[model samples]
Target: MNHDNLLAPYAARSAASRGRKHEEPYKDSRPVFERDRDRIIHCAAFRRLEYKTQVFVNHEGDYYRTRLTHSLEVAQIGRGIARRLHLNEDLVEALALAHDLGHTPFGHTGEVVLNRLMADHGGFEHNRQSLRIVELLEERYPGFDGLNLAWETREGIIKHSSQYDHPGHPEDDDFEPHQRPTLEAQIIDLADEIAYNNHDIDDGLKAGYITLDELAALEIWQDMSALVSRKYPHLRGERQAYQTISHLIGHLIDDLVQTTTENLKAYHIDNLEAVRSHPDYLVRLSGETARKNKQLKAFLYRQLYRHYKVERMRIKAERFVTLLFTSYKENPTLLPRKLQQRFDEHGKERVICDYIAGMTDRSALDEYKRLYEPYERV
Candidate 1:
């Protein structure tokens, strides 16, 4: 109940200060929670997220999860988990909302290309890029550099235990040791998985890329159906799909709540921050659940991600991105003056490419078309 601890979860300092975003206004009209949320919502990165890919490309159908929609879903799911667990709601919302702010266009395809192109200039990692976006990229208040977000928010974005965990501590020279992510951060990662897993299947079905029969035929889907039916026997057919996935989401939330509650209970009574810091402290899913999640991930990769049609599209996207980077470097005049300034300061071709790669699909395409086809607008 300490006020400092209450605020501690959302505090973020700049490269200048070892603290959090201070929303000092003429008058204190909004809570720090509301202010932080609004700041993230209004930032250029947040807006750009709308045009970034979640799984599908921008040229794909509109119903797929763009980065913006995915963030919104993750935020909603995270907030739900936070409310049930009595954790800090604002911190969870902020974590979920800003988690993917630094993602490159064309989903992982663009990330792969950029990482190859910029391996020397500290490489292009989205988590690190996200940290940069909030800490330095966003342009707003004059006195501040970046958003000056809460340390917890930044930690959640960069250290949330996905494959994307960036280097954090000094033990590894190539990368930082990952920060010990909080329970709220853990929930956001699970929420992201849950949100995307179910929705991507839905989108695939809608796009005619995957048939409902194909989905049901998978052993994982069959088990998922069985689990849903065992849990809620009343649902069947279309109701099964809707109700089953809903049940899965609820089940995951329940697991997270129970597991996090146990950890919090231990944390409340113990002097062993060291023990609590272990990754096992936050992992909630059972062996069965873990297996199921893996199966689903594998199924998606084999069926949706590696489909020849989708792979061809992604290959083309990689070529387009490469072309843009090559052209931009050859003729730096095509870049904005601000970008030129960055180029002069960093003096690295890959760093410049990193900046461009972090753009949304539409922005990247626009930049490409602007330079290559000056007369025609994309």
Candidate 2:
């Protein structure tokens, strides 16, 4: 079936996509956004997300969410919202999956170290790095360096923002940075928060970073826990925690859908033009949900993220990234031959940052050992 036939006027229909940077023939059956989604899923950078950390380090545990799983969860949530609103699910899914393509291994700590290291050389930001990946990094097509994604998907990735992410892609002048992105792109921002917050709660509890008694004090957790207990009276322990988290995700999705619908009506957004011209995001939480979410984030910051154990891992990750960047900067020959050639075009600091940003957690660690350890195999 032709998917483009179903998009609403306000939706980003594939037939009308801004198209790729380098023009290519379209596969007749698949919509452009669907092709974009397929291309992203098949890219090498997408696969490396598995070894990249979300909260805990890659070596911390098998159960903690990796960037890959987090991306999938964001896509699932984004699609749910898109379907509910008759928006473009394919575009939402593509944005969701591709948003984290440029994330460094070992989570935000790695980003911090790399940013400081590159301060003299244009600086580093994951959102910009993500755009760089799609526009320049991934070498899939012989004709193009990056994935050559549609302009909309690239904009969505650049606009990916949340409590932690401060989105900006100054180099992406093709898309209007001053205005809001499509509502489908906006959904990924909320989906990222909903996915990470609830999943982190599970991981935190399992890691014994936070306790049930302590969680009981939080408003959102308590509200969901009561619902889980009422619905599954016999469920307890890990099963209960799972059920509660499941309900909480549903709760957040419900709030986002309802509130976003209200905002759409309030703003008089009729088509894609209105969404772009709007000054602020049209998709967001209700006042009540936003207030409660603030409490939830504040609690996580003081209780889980700032916990001494998590800080220890952060320190280690920062050290790994700093040392690795410094070594490569001192001697550019250490990079792979192909990357060494790019140093003339991309420059030493940027080429090194690209190489480091592209590495998976274990790959970064292994590289560290190879360079610093006398006995480690190169």
Candidate 3:
């Protein structure tokens, strides 16, 4: 697995990879991170992402961004950023692809209900569940219970700082919370933000939940609008909207690259050691872009995320997850035979939680109907 790489001095080199939790023979063609990426892609949990929620549920629409597409978008942006900065593209790609593997079917709504249900066991967070997935849930290889991913990949999953994920929580206790993750891992967070924000804009527009005229009120929207107009004067309607999003993504990446490069210089961080030991995170957007991005986020929160339609989905998601948990808790026999066998080892509630968390949105709904309708297919 020792492949020659032209990584930045501060980049995470594959040769220096902290070995997996379980030892295994290495492959010759693909490097460690590449294998990690392939392993994630082949896992059952990763495939379930197609039906997992991002903003809209699976049955909501065909075109809306699902968890699968969102993960792909994050990887696309992360790889572009990684390449530009001479960072580890393979690790960045792996982190981006694997980051959302632990997300529940109904998105944050599912996570909230699981947290409430498992309050006495251990609170549920997608990030921790993600690590749990790669560490012990995915029973792929004969010798290992989980993927036994490289330690750096696992650390990135644990500490993937995002708008939804804040650091210093008890969950981060497993690692050195004081030190920063690799430069590549650090990029995943910002890349996630960049992907979700812009894609949300697109999905909201396509769904008619948000209008172009409404977006005019936001400064970032106006900035992009002007650029799109000038760059392609004849472009109109949906095409204009699409191009504006493309332009915005480009601009954000430009800002992030520029800002991260400047931070590297400002901190005099010459190597991976310096990046880890730095007191604060050094990869970031410039001040101006940060403010603009925040404004856009606020607009999405108020206008799109908190809008009546999205809230309605969130409410139903809560109920579905809650009822499912309750039913399983009352009658453990209701769970599939395989999961029932896990109860003795992991506890009934934890086993049930894992079973439910692993379900796709469509399958969860199907399970509900099968359980409640009586006449529905078993």
For the record, the alpha-carbon RMSD of candidate 1 to the native fold, in angstroms, is 4.3
Off by over 4 Å in 2: none
- Clash totals for all models, in order? 16, 0, 0
Instruction: Please tell me which model should have the higher lDDT, number 1 or number 3.
Output: 3
> In model 3, which residue pairs have backbone atoms overlapping below 3 Å?
none
lDDT per residue, candidate 3, 210-267, as tens digits?
9999988888888998999998999999999998899999999999999999999998
Please provide TM-scores, in order, for all candidate models, with all chains considered together.
0.84, 0.97, 0.97
Candidate 1 lDDT tens digits, 162-257: 644454533232222433555666777788887888777777766667766877766657766789888778866567777666766776667667
| Residue 144 shift from truth in candidate 2, angstroms | 1.6
Better of 2 and 3 by lDDT: 3
Q: Residue-wise lDDT of candidate 2 within 1-378, one digit each (tens)?
A: 767567666778887888888977654768778888998999988999999998888788899999999999999999999999889999999999998888998888888888888888888889899888888888878777888888888888888887767665457576787878888899999999999898999999999999889989988889999999898899889999989889989999999999988888898888999988988898888898888888988888899999999999888888899888888888878889998988889898999998999999999999999999999989
